[model samples]
Target chain A: MARKLASEDLTPVAGGGLLHRRLFLKAGLVLATAQTATSLRAEEVAATTPRAKPEDPADPSWIHKPGLPFTGYGTPSKYEKHVVRNIGGNRTPQGDGVSWTPLEELEGIVTPSGLHFERHHDGVPDIDPAVHRLVIHGLVQRPLEFTVANLLRYPMRSRFLFIECGGNSNAGWHEEPIQRPAGSFHGLVSCSEWTGVPLSLLLDEAGVDPKASWVIAEGADAGLLNVSLPLSKLMDDAMVGLYQNGERVRPENGYPLRLIVPGWEGITNVKWLRRLHVTDAPAMTRNETAKYTELLPSGKARMFTFVMDAKSLITSPSPGQKMHGANVYEIRGLAWSGRGKISKVEVSADGGKSWAEAELQDPVMSQCFTRFRSPWAWDGKAALLKSRATDETGYVQPERDVLIKERGREGYFHYNAIVCWAVDEDGTISHVYA
Target chain B: MSMLRCVAALMIAVSVASLAVAEEDTRVKGHIDGAHGSAAVEPAASANMRLGTPLTSDDIAKWDRTIFPDGRGLPPGRGSAKEGRVIYEQKCARCHGEHGEGGTSEELVSGPTPPSPDNPSKAIGSYWPYATTIFDFVRRSMPPAAPGSLSADETYAVTAYLLAANAIIPESAEMNAETLAAVRMPNRDGFIWIDVKK
Candidate 1:
């Protein structure tokens, strides 16, 4: 029998009504407890009962239906149309704009190809693959021009990685949390399975001169965007990606060809790439000089600080969301590091006073997304929840004040501090400096 | 009979002349229409044609768009600080500022120190490490709205003005492609190498 609730029962969680931040995994409180139970029963049946070999080829499940047909291109399921990147372009110029990926609504690591974030200075160029070519010139032993077909024939590997725009989270430098959705605040970053040939392979094919230490990568967009990358990184884990999320790259995300610099900002991973000019030194492009440079308190500027530090954020129970009741819940989110694998993720229910180790999902690849989960109990009390990720390099995420103090108040780019969420008595959640 | 014969001859001549004119009109119209048709679907235009003239070693013999950490990517042009001042007023002052100062939304010529845990200021004279970066950046994207539009000479003039304003280059010194590539920046050695040693 369900008891009628009084109006007073809907009181806030605490003074701020923030929910209990820690995942208090009580009995039977897994986020997917209902589904897990069924799977667990299936495992038990297989272990205890004698298994009989199936004689019939036309099983009931297979006889009635075959799988969906193949498609040249694919879109998200009908139920997932709401998960598209929140595109916002300039009213006058249709091509100039950005789209924020809905990070909070997604689960696990892979960001479906359709939902990858976009930051285009100019409009997306409709390039014909037939005529596309990648030219390697400048300080190389031999200049080579490879068509799209030639590039596809090279050996390739797949990696689950994240590419974040350098300007992302620049809004954090603003005075307030800029209330919106969690995605808008942190959506500029997205992770996907990128498959491509190693850039070193192509550079080797071009016979990079021994003195060539830098390469100027240029894109074919209207802006003719170009930037210089250290040859060391090019020879490292960098890839000339041809696929994203197990399919040919999307036009918005550098279809036909693109460069993937693992763990670096998105700008360096140029889209619609057309040329790479090996050079002895940096090109000092506008991106490296005028923009993406941070002002330090020590009377110096931090220019080519490329690697994105370890960062994590709780998605559900985040801002603009709420809790149902004093029931058990699953606290889940994603953590990643540009330097390497995420070592551990810690969650705090009462601000940063208490932290508990959350379970990291398996198949944790380097420079890839690592999903984390922990159980929590909401005792109808206000609580603050937060997540902090520590990378394999033993670099613990810094607090807001730490980052600000180190980088100075003028610092805007690479804003990766721990994120906190506060739940009110009415179960409404919002961003909090705590 | 003579009047009837004359009328028949006039009608035949008019018909033949009109037929010739119609043929000429069809040929002219067909050529004009074909010339203006959309080429996207036609696949006749070749993008592989060399852009501009073929650049050989000889053609690039004098073009020195290269930069080292010290100074580089400067084009073959020269400008005096005095000339730069006049150029700045006519071209740059509207957006940049009167005395190498910055405008709203534009970075000031002089600036903050390198980014660190404390003081964060970004400016050309104070923070930039290599003088070459300034030349590269100005040449690639600058003047706000009109990027890659400045002449090689104008680019050198603006670069000289900026360097002089930053107190790097002497006020009376001249900056050509060769001299510009020799100027040094304040924070040239102020970078932390990623310690991913094998």
Candidate 2:
């Protein structure tokens, strides 16, 4: 029997009282007082209990009343105050590592806008949007300059997509398992509803020269960051997003403007967008040359790999989550791809020894989030849970060892391998190689 | 019959005039750049910026050091291997290493080998399609922590050291605007024309 936090002297009942994470739809648990009442003999306690009958409903607690007014924007409930993106940096030093995103405490398809993850090379620059100017010069019939307000006047569209850091899941590449919640390992990727004007319109307005085949996109951060992208992709599905969720984007997520290349990794989508210079080829910036470029096992370095392949993760049944002894559990998670739609997702109960197809939720969108679920029965034995996504192009998610063998020990960027979580007999969960 | 024809002609003229007036009104709804017949106009604001304000031109420009595939952002800086060795240790070696071998989470130098379909390195001396990218990237996002803090002279010197270490440039060579732009990369000829069709 268990009691809630407040009702039990501000402390929850110890030892597996927390409900199984797989039970997502239930509001709360049954308390000990209610359970004891059912077990008690009715006649012995009837005189002292003085229980209110069903018809005695004249007065209800004022706390069970109507709530406050509506708001233009929304935030997470006060109960989720501890769920914040943890940022770590050296006080005297800068451009350091940051760990910790509270992935254990979230649910549903969309990540709340405020709790989206961040990784900064330099400190976040407090930019003045008024002074920000987007210059479109170099190899154009008519070079144009646009203020943020000018760009907003154009027609716009919205999409629900995810932006993932290239270095995400680097912990997976390690020899030993780095135990943490799913978010810290994969939180670098977050989904949002982005609204923006398509890149095709701006490219058309500038009148791209016939010889111009590559665009050198630059940002206005203190870094003055720049990288080259193929002109074809830039004009294809790229967007200059200004709004995330239903409101203007937060500063950490690129205030005023950012380039959103659907299905592409996050670095190519420059934030604090400032300039685009049309050119003949890639500038071959350090990021393109030395970094993001991976050396394959055959000794050939894979460069200019722009598209992010299909990937998915089971959020609820993942590691650091608890389980109640042997019952039915509903597996829930999200999947997406940059190439196109996820055609199918298969879940494994014994770590790929046996596979069962999971149910993909309705309204599956291209280059957007597709939630998946599967019903499972636990017979009180140790097992492993894993999911593999196959995209529309017939590319199946590779195993961890397969990716390592092909990419070699030198692999640093774009690690998209199947993830496995081992559930022990005692109901403890952890990352496993499987 | 003549009176009826005259009345019809008069009605046509009146309708045409009203249509012309409506078209004019819609076109000038926001601003009036030019004078049109019977259109309400907004007076133009007076200019404050005077004629003799110093022009910020590319001529005598300070920050034109953004090298592209066609070699545009390279600036005036010259350094030899002997001088570069000092600069490399003082500034770059803290992260990159003593022999340009690279540290953990850092990149190594040395490239210019042919695209190894069997084995690809993609280092400065190997798989880079253009040498100009090295100069451009170093000027922008190098040192990881302190980006865009290097001077033109430092960038050119560092690029020269990396090239020499990668065996592209000789030990005693010096690099400047003209010589740096002229340097070719190994994989420049390996690119395929992959673009989306309209």
Candidate 3:
């Protein structure tokens, strides 16, 4: 039973032919917009549109014949093979690079487990859970080591959280606006359902010394990647994740264990977690002091910047896809922040000249992706599109110019600015600085 | 949740010589807080869930090799830049360049000056804040392919060679644990830590 809305409800909420937010809530209200769909050729329409069946519908070949047997596991439909992670700078044998999630083709907030973006320093190691162990030492009352079986005995909590690389959208610092897909440019961050035991329980079991204020975490990969985090953070909300998406984690995603630090950079959520050493001071690892740190125009570098600020991106009608000739289309996108839940997301269709609030989907979780959408009417004219996000902390995503004025064009990390896509008159969408 | 008090019933298998296990925690031995009870672990009951194989110093020495910037974990080894040059050319030069000016790998030495974002030369001499990091990184993961292949003395020699090449130390200086811990790089004071009581 689809709900209907009157055509009179198609009122422009903002400038440049934007529709009311309620258009999304009412079922099939898109049909009431003068019955105008994207102008499709008769051949393309006939191929997909269902044909009327005779009184006695005949069974198709798949139904008439015996079906294929079930396999041990299942995979995505072969037709959807194009949907995959985009690997960049791939040097295979001596692994070092990253992969981007194709955000434009995805819908809703939850990213599929297989499509989660990956960044490897020395490639994913094949760890046999039978022999792997997590050791807790340094400033503790007793040094204890636990095998995978031991951790599973502890109580577990599940949460939908996000882990964003500190350098996720750093390309925005380019003097010229980078012309790439939304995900390729800003897909280093990903969200998922993680189930694990609270780290405080384990830390308490180890009995942390009064002198310890920092915890150095290291992975089991070839690089032995390490970083120092504030002790309070691990006790507050960090967990040693044992499961992802209700199943044993994949090898590339820390099969045995991963430190899921909510609202922090991805590197701090150390994967293939092998050791935790409590101390009084930070180790000042290479990642912290040399790489992740940002150099400012002031001739100084900003280090230990753990929290990612508010950011949003309009995914649909973005680069790489051609728009249908002059019709109403839904402008949808994703919004998130490391501080807390996203409070609001405002969309603009005229180069940020006029704005309207997009409807946020339900279950707007903290430190998780929030999907937002708004109905847009295009009259076959050129237009600029953008989305701005505001987290619960009252921090709004800054404009490109505003961010540049404060941080400067020299910054190579932590770039979160309003993204704009120019819709050309020919229905071709492209990335633009406007 | 008194994790310390709950230890009144567990026995740790540790000799008197081991400082790794606190003396007070090894007093008792018995069953862990009802592993047979309902699996739903409430915080009150699970506080007593002290589990894991108590590790002795010998059991962890092989894996506990990460060195601190203050040289807390530096092994008892020493090496000089003159000895390091031979090791550098044979093992490190092909990737890091003959002069450590960077070829296929990161630049290890460069002129000491402030690094601007445009000319962001994050070479060791310009950006790295600690001299001990060269030893720490080289020993932990270097040569990009086979990590942990260098012995402690070789790592110290490479550290000495790089430091001398960067003009931070004398070419003839033999670096030991105490000396390496005290060697300050040019940008040692350039770091600023926030959000903690550093």
Candidate 4:
């Protein structure tokens, strides 16, 4: 008992066969062609989206046999083993590199903690909760230390936020487009619902001295990694994250505790956090002084450039994904902003010639990933796909060329630019600079 | 508690706190000026919970490991680059190379040419803005495999040797708390600190 999808539903909203979002919202409605069938509407949807059907309906093996018993921890289906962290590259100690989240293989906002992208300084330290301690000292009137049990006594709040490495999307700096999967190419970022006590309360209890301008947060990892964070941020929205996605934080993602500085760069969210030294000046740690700092064309480096900025990526129909030849495909993607919420996301199908606003999924939290979707009709011809995001602050994501011109060719960190995917006539898609 | 409740409380807490925080934009620290509405939830009071134990000066001194740029926390010890050469070969040579040009670890020596976009050397001499960081890093996390294993004297020696290798100091010059903190870095003014508004 549903109304037939009108021909107007199949109208192209933009160039390159981009259709209205309502047409492909429901698979049943898209297929339920009534009187419109046998007309031009039928011809328009001739190669409609294909949903899988069994050779003999209701004869699937999974339902006919006895299901296996479940354990305490359940994993994705065996068939989904391909979806995993793309841990690549060679490092000096083999434990110092990053593993990318397979963005193309997942959807929605929260990244599974197990599959969260990881960038470790040395290696994951096996920490004992009983032995782990967080000491708040230096410039405070009374230096205090808290055990895991002590932290549990405090009232906790949770927020969905993203932690993006400053070096993420550096591959975009290459002269030629890196032909990697969207997730592997730009998956060094992930979102999580981190639950913990607001750091302001703890700092208040410890009684912050008036002279302390910055705090040097140190992790308990092998390198004893550290970074300097502005006191304002820690007081505003940062959390001493003890839980990720409702459970105790995964070890690789900072098990016992992680400093969740909301929208700041990942290094500042020191994992396995052990110390917070309030000081009048920054500690000038190696990570703050040399590593996370971005070199500019002016020869002066940009240090403490903390905000991740606004960025968006089309997960499907991007590089490594293929097209079901000449079909009505629903393009899905994600958008987020560090300054505030994402106000809009636009889809360009004809290489930026024309663009249409994408339908944003609900509950678009501030400083968190926002899901976006657009519908497209491919007529077995070459096409280009790109998505651009604008944050609530009216900051639009710049195009690749525009970004390059502003931040020279050499700057590696904070590369938030539009991404383009070129689809060939033969049903293959690859990364493009356009 | 439902997930939505936590989010709702936080959102209200955030809006209220942001308005309260706008006044103290210039100051760095003090008694918590904002974000107090978060505690305004149930329990009406957090000072009553009274978690965490206070530490004496001796207790803080034991765990206070941060090294500041203005000669605040460098431990008492001294070593010359001459004495550090032997320690460097034995403890650091395999990863850092013989001359600090980089082996498996990062390059430590200054560049043969001036820093340019094409040949930007992020070595200790060309990039790091402070000299005390060298001693702090070595003493805390060095050798890659066994961290915090070097003595104060040995770390000072390695810092002196690396400084000498980069031609920032003389091989005979000893590195102590005072002398090491006094050594000025070439790129001390290379970073833009105007973005500290965060």
Best by lDDT: 4
CA lDDT, every model vs. true structure: 0.71, 0.68, 0.80, 0.82
Worst 10 residues of 3 chain A by lDDT: A31-40
**TM-score result, candidate 4:** 0.87
**Residue by residue across A1-434, what tens digits does model 4's lDDT show?**
35675677768999998887656555335421111111324345545746475345557767777899867798997756667899965477766789998888788999999899999977899999999999999889878999887786566888999888888889999999999888888999999999998888789878999988899999999979888888878988888899999999989999799999877888888999999999888888888887888777767788888988999999887766556677677788999888899999999889999998898998899999999988887777988899999999999999999998877776688999999989899777889898
Q: lDDT for model 3, on a 0 to 1 scale? A: 0.80
lDDT of 1 at A420: 82
Candidate scoring better on lDDT of 1 and 4: 4
Model number with the top DockQ: 4
Tens-place lDDT per residue, model 3, A1-434, is 46665576567788777777667677455531211112223346667888785233575546667877887688887756767888985653357788888887688887888988888888898999989999998889888898888787676778898778887878888877777778889888878899987888889888899998999999998878888899999989899999988887778888899999888888899999999988888877787877787777776777778888889999887876667768778888999998999999999989999998999998899999999988887777998999999999999999999998887776577888999999899877788887
A116-226 per-residue lDDT for model 1 (tens digits): 999886678799998877777778776667777767655567888999888777777776876766787888889999998777767776778998888888876665678
Q: What is the TM-score of each candidate against the true structure?
A: 0.72, 0.74, 0.87, 0.87
Candidate 2 vs 3: which has more DockQ: 3
Question: In model 3, what are the clashing residue pairs, if there are any?
Answer: B10-B28
Fnat, model 3, is 0.41
Candidate 2's DockQ is 0.15
Q: What is the lDDT of residue A414 in candidate 2?
A: 81
User: Which lDDT tens digits does candidate 1 get at residues B1-99?
Assistant: 233234434545554676667667767767976534221211111212111122355534433344554444445677777777787787667756788
Q: After superposition, how far is residue A93 of candidate 2 from its true place, in Å?
A: 6.2
Model 1's number of clashes is 42
Q: Summarize candidate 2's per-residue lDDT along B17-85 as a digit string, tens digits.
A: 766676778678535646455532321111210111121344213323346666676766776666767
In candidate 3, what are the lDDT values of residues B1-198, reduced to their tens digit?
A: 244234322222222223333332333221433233222322222346677677888877866866788988889999999989999998888878899988766687886665765566778887888777788878887756787888989989988988899888899999989999999877776655544556
Which 10 successive residues of model 1 chain A have the least lDDT summed?
A29-38
Candidate 2: deviation at residue B195, Å? 8.8
